[model samples]
Target: MSPTIGAIVIPVSDLESAKKVYTALYGEPHTDQPYYVGFNVNGFEVSLNPQGEGGPVAMTDVDDLDATRNALLAAGATEQSAPRTVAPDVRICVLADSDGNPFGLRGK
Candidate 1:
């Protein structure tokens, strides 16, 4: 199956400032914390991460994280991070394309 974008995480130097701006555009966030703020736009998750560097990274949902990650690596994508569990059953990882643009993969 093909991967689909599930979330877009934007990097911010100042969490509070970014929160204010995003909140104004998308309304109140469903999840608010010091490290991350999340808003549900329709069914998609829009998040702010102070720890995230560079620009926004799009998180794509895949069926098999390991297989897909390996395929991407074989296709010239470099691993920025290994797959790690975020929530109870949710896992995520970061990778950069050949040109060095970062993207994310999220799965169970």
Candidate 2:
């Protein structure tokens, strides 16, 4: 078995809108394929999957979520809550982007 992520799937309300957002952020699309537009940058391989419910609330782990939270805040993301323990092995904080989709960052 592989010890790393095979890939990630992100769902979006509008494929066109998501494509534009991801393109601006990542700076390039991973593939020339027309159906999906995205690429692997940094550690994440982002793909915009068109679907109904919502995009992913990425659970990121960091040594200092307070700092990470601050960064995200400065970039226009809103803090839904401060970091708190959810389980013995989990501590997480919720955040929402300008579009109101919720995502979390966790620390061990």
Lowest summed lDDT window (length 10), candidate 1? 81-90
User: Which lDDT tens digits does candidate 2 get at residues 1-108?
Assistant: 212332355767678777878888888785735455557788675666564245455656666667777899999999876887845875667789898878777654
Over 4 Å off in model 1, which ranges?
Answer: none
Per-candidate total of colliding backbone pairs: 0, 1
Error of 2 at 21 (Å): 34
- Candidate 2 regions exceeding 4 Å error are 1-56
Candidate 1 residue pairs in clash (backbone atoms < 3 Å): none
| TM-score (C-alpha) between model 2 and the true structure | 0.43
TM-score against native, each model: 0.94, 0.43
List per-prediction Cα lDDT, in the order shown: 0.93, 0.67
Cα-lDDT of candidate 2: 0.67
